[model samples]
Target: MLKMMTFFQGLPGQQSLLGTLDPGLSEAESEASMSEASSEDLIPPLEAGVTPDGEQEGTSKKKKSKGLANMLSVFIKGKKKKDQPRSSETEVKSKARPELEGPPPTVEELKAALERGRLEAARPVLALERELEAAAAAGGTSDEELVRLQSKVEALYVLLRDQVLGVLRRPLDAAPERLRQALAVVAEQELEDRRAAAGTRAAALVDTLWRGGVEEVAAERLGARPAGVPAGLSEAESRFLHMGRTMKADLEAVVERLKPLFPAEFNVVHTYAQSYHQLFAAHLDTLAQFELCERDTYLLLLWVQNLYPNDILNSPKLAQELQGIRLGSLLPPKQIKLLEATFLSNEVANVKLLMNRALELESQRWAQDVAPQRLNGYCHCELAIDIIQIISQGQTKAENITSDMGMQIKQLLLVELASMLRSYQHIFDEFLEKSKLLKNYRANIIANINNCLSFRTSMEQQWQIPQDSPSHLMDPLKELKAHGFDTLLQSLFLDLKLLFKKFTQTRWAAPVETLEEIIATVGSRLPEFSELQNCFREELMEAVHLHLVKEYIIRLCKRRLVLKTAEQQQQLAKHIEANAEAIQSFCTQNGSTATWLHPALPTLAEIIRLQDPSAIKIEVATYATWYPDFSKGHVNAILAIKGNLSNSDVKSIRNILDINTGVQEASRSLFSLIKVV
Candidate 1:
């Protein structure tokens, strides 16, 4: 356009003048000189109006100008590649190829092609690979179709690798944009067709002994497994998962059925673990009663045992310590053993797990709350009562019961209690008697054990109770049946009665007066002998009083109370009638003395009965002293003193000396010596 302005304004000479004028920049003058020195200096002017006038007169030339303008505009619009030089491919030699193949494409290439085509693209890919294999073996390989196939595969692989890897990293909640777009474009019927294909693969995996590809080819393609897990586990896992789902589903059913009655009795935080354990056991136990055709007992047990030990017990270790054991307190040792042995014996590590868990549970101690649920046990069930009664009744009638066990158990548990109430009163007396014949060890010393009640309660509640206690402690009846506790209990009650009976008698109670009478009638009296005699009298008196009080009074009162109450009387009468109560017949006493006597007896006769006449020492009767041989002399003196007391008052008088062989000699000596002195 500047050159055109120059032509209109003044011509070439004027243009040169404009060009030579001092411009704002020296670079501008030098640049203009350089441009003029090149093209303009080299090209001479064309002959004026020569071939150009003929060339320019035609219509075709105008058309050609118009076409050229359109072509120039198109070229300018798409000139991005024109500025860059292109390399000649054929002139560039490729690297040496010595490929030989059965099927040319590597597995990776084949997979990429298939995935890129979505499985349909593999046929052409595989064909091209075969051609490459053939051509390589022939030492010549080229075809436009094969080249096109290779190009398509290369492009497909690049696209497919990127897309598949991206899919692999995609979050489960969302797929890639490409996949989402593809899925959106898929017609519903076409989707059903693809699903049917996936279904066939899965169906193959369902067969037994299905192996390898059956799972991978089947599960992944079908998306059967949720994540990375295999499509199936053992039969056991299936059953467990099934039962878990069933239990969860039926929970609402159970709530619906039980909510009206509120079976939440076992649902408190206080007993939640225990209630769960029991319910687990009970559900299975009850389930065992039915014929479950589809279920396996071993499997259910495995399931429950698995869940309870770790999930229930160990998961929540006691966070708060409770003062007492919160569960399994009343459970028997054998039951606990069964649990340990069956469920946890092998999992020795689980013991600590459970202990720590118990600690955790203890930490989470709930309030001692009883708002909605009562703490009462359902063991008040009729079955419990029926069982206990059966034990009680069958226990009494069984002659086959182990008779000895009762005695052993009584010795174990009740001896201290019995001794507490039955010890001789004289056991506490401060009395000392000197022996007459023995050279040494003469004195008989006694001290009271009356204030030892503390000893008694401790012996019973603490020692005996703690020894057996809540668990491993043997069952009283099981021990009874093993030990025949029936006899021991009965004898214990009887002895109590007899002791009460003995405490009440007052007749012949004055043993001192009777001693005076026997001495006066039988023989001479000794001076200063009252003191020694008084000690013996005091001991005998106390024994007689205790025996009478406990055997007679306490027992008689107890029996009378029983008869006074209508319930007791009726119960006793009915029991006796029902039992055909066994009665002991009279039998000879052991050795030389009767084991029992009439409730009331004269002192002289009682003394005679207790004495072994063959063992009596006559010299002891004369001495009026404690004999070395268990005090035969003392025995004779007491008997001689009480021998002739009247029948009406004989027992007390006889008992005052507490007649037996020792009293017999002692009494005689007292009778004779007091007179002689």
Candidate 2:
């Protein structure tokens, strides 16, 4: 059969189908060839017909060709029968032998094949790689072939790197399918590397392809200066602001678009998040090397320490996606501390400058004899408003940097606030003394009093400064408050002085007229009191009410109204009770929350009205209960006014009062204000 097949290959118009086919193919290649062979390979080439195009010259030639084909068929069939057992044995031996699969792709072929293309287009090259690797493993491929195969794979990955990174450089949402394809490539490469125990090669691809792509995107986005940069912002300030805006936008795109397309093992969200964070930190470190201004320093600190970590990284939508990511600070801790220190120093100086500027402006107004502005029918000044706003805003911004920074800021504000208060106090005193515009002066005094009240309340409530604890803050406030109140109410006090004098001169005879006149005088001032702020109005009213009660009792304590008769003492007690009720009604009606002072005058009247010694003793004990500051001297003074009690009776009453002493004192005391002579 072999001799006949070889002899046929040399004949004119005749060729053998098995002429060049190799029977000694390695087992693997033989199986591959067997599976891959087509029907054309099993059949002879078209008979050397009239022409290679399969055209016949004539019918005569076609008939002759038919006779020839019949003879060739008979011969081929006989040969196949004779070689059948030998062919079976050859196929069996080929299966049993281990053989090299094939030669790997040539360098030129791989280079041309691995040219940059879409990630999906690289599948053919990867298939070729698997075949070459199998050939090498079967122990039939030479070292040269193995090295060539290794080079092809390395070049293929290089192409993959370029294509994958190119996909990542575009916006995540621009071609989500393309991003998905690129990630799929990375996933396969990672799996291949893992099975081969090729450490970190897959990781390097992710770092160079995904992370490097992020750095490129971030740089491009951050370089875009936003429209209408505010006029006064430094270059650093504008850049920092733009960085925050762009970082958030890019990270959000990855989370919203790419996360769903990739699987969890890909760590798509964390990869994007960490890349953005590391790049951001590096950029901030560059910025921190310079001497930033106050605004820029604060903005830098805000982004690194607060805004990035809390508002951006932990935002509701992005937080869950980035939960697995451990992106660190936008700047190193030491750098952040330096920025904080610079910001706090600048803020401290800035606060002082603002407060001083506000004070200077107020001083100008005072020097120009400007009338204090009226707001909602009340005297108003911007001194407190401006200074408080300065400190409050400073403290708020400082806190945005850190809590410890905020406390330091508060301490700085306290010092500046104390100085401002002291300076304002002196300027106000000079203005009140020298300014000739009487109505404007009075309005300014009242406004300044309101200012002090407002300032103190803000320190205590908003700043949480303990009252009566920080003498520097509270003591200056106290002095300014007292002076302003005394100056504003000087006339009111003089009027009360005359009213009380008239009562003592009348010897308790015209109690109704004298006390009613006093009540009328205090009521007339309520409209002016109403002009003060609510906080100030209440405080002023309480002070006046306590002073009135103290003055009334002091007049009686003068011992001029000695009621020798029981009837006289009862009448006087009725007058005192009526006065106490009228005073309380007026004070309460005019917005006094000093409910503690309500019983001070009434209890004193009850002690005078009681006829029996034991009754009087019980009333004195009640007085002591209400006004724990009610002293032995107070009881003696009241008894002397009664004049019905002998020395022995007074001593017994005093003893009863002593027994009830040491009770809890009221928060605001009227008896403590009175000095019984």
Candidate 3:
């Protein structure tokens, strides 16, 4: 019981009741009394302190003392009624409200409560947003709530935008290193997005601005113009100039802005410039469709070309497209065709016609001057040179005009040159025929031949056509000149043959005057034959020498020297001396013929001077050794002229004949006819 009283004294608000408890009571009975008391009845009372109405400090203290006494009384009553049975009212009240009981909340439940608190805090903002959306969906209205909501939303938006911009802008200036790195990544992403968006917008804007500007300019330029009539740009020029200047400024601004971001990519600027150029091209095409005047079209094309300049045209990115947009392509098809015809086809045709006319005039002049009476004029046939010069001049003009046309003209000139050579050859042939009738026609013919050769030489030097020139165009000129030289050579030889035949037929007794005439006529002209003089003159002189020597031998054989009287022998010897002198004079006068004739002339003079048959036989044998044509007839004839020779003299002649003689049988018979002792 004492322990129970001590436990009761330790209980809060039960100390006052401890003194009232029966100390003599058993511990079990005291516990029963404490358990019987109601917990509310055991509660402490509130002390009235400061009241709303003004109250004295003593009254406040008395209220606090009365509250303390009431607290003590409740404590005593709760202790006194602890073992007593509860009243029916308290029991009924307890039954009416069952005691509430639950376990403590877990972490998840606490987290859920915190989330709910956050949601509850955001409810006002969400409600305001929903109201704003509803008002917007309802369309614009003067409703006060809607207006208030809109104003609120706008203000909220501005604040949010300022906050976002502030965050974005502040990092670069004030963020720490680590935060700055993160911001850089975000900034890079934003830049890429902006670039992509700008690319698309730029393309669309370029196209839109270009088309609008071009259309506006065109409308102003062509609105009142008549169909098929080109309009003057008095009014339109200003607009065009303005458009170009504006476009250039805009393009420069765009390039300057984009250059830093994409320094290596020309396409950024190329795309915009292409749009501007394409607009200009479209305008040009439209003007072309209206049958724009040549002058206007030219001026417009110039303007476009000048506006674009090499910087735009030669841009590595757009080179191919710019190459396609030349002045030629911008011109109308009809104009282009007309230009080609005028410069290329018509010019070539005109050159060919002029060449033909020049060639015809040259032919007529050649015909008029190449007459037989005007044989001296043959050397001065300026036809070929004149024709070549005219063609060359024409070629120069044509080349200045166009290279292709010049080439055609040059080819035609070559053909004409060949034709002129052929005509010259024809004139020469006619001249050759007429010349055959003249007494000294060979001289005239040689002069004409020399003139032709000289002209050909000059032509060769003047015109150095390449070997790779077209064969058909070049071959005729080459062949004709060569053929002309060959023909002239053949004609000269033919005339020579005729002159030699005439001399041979005269029995070599033709006067020195005749030989002199032949030499003067042909030899004087020899120097003019240029390179051909040596061979031609050598052969011709050889023929003359041979015929003259044969005739002299015959004349010597025919002479009858009667050596029975010294006076008669002297007369015959003098006759032989006169004939030998004539032969010597003829051979000496013509140097080309004298080479073989000179050695034989002295032998003939010796034979005549000795007047001995033995001397004749010795000389004749020596002459035969030199000239194999010397025959037995020559020996017999000379012996016959000597009359009867002494036996020793005849034997000496026969011994000379027997020395390995290989004469013909007919010539041997003449030897057999000789009577040798």
Clashes of each: 62, 0, 3
The parts of candidate 1 lying over 4 Å away from their true place are 1-123, 136-149, 156-505, 508-612, 615-677
Residue 504 Cα positional deviation in candidate 1, in Å, after optimal superposition: 8.2
- Highest lDDT, which number? 2
Poorest stretch of ten by lDDT in candidate 3: 1-10
* Candidate 2 local lDDT, residue 568: 84
lDDT of each: 0.29, 0.67, 0.43
Cα deviation of 470 in candidate 2 (Å)? 5.9
Task: Please write out the lDDT profile of model 1 over residues 181-288, one tens digit for every residue.
Answer: 322222221232233233232222211111221223222322222233336555444534543433333333323332232223323123322333344455455544
Best by TM-score: 2
> Model 1 residue 347 lDDT?
28
Per-residue CA lDDT of candidate 3, range 459-555, in tens?
5565554555555544544444444444445544555445545433653445355445644555554454433333344544554454455544444
For all predicted structures, in order, the TM-scores are 0.21, 0.66, 0.31
Q: How accurate is candidate 1 locally (lDDT)?
A: 0.29
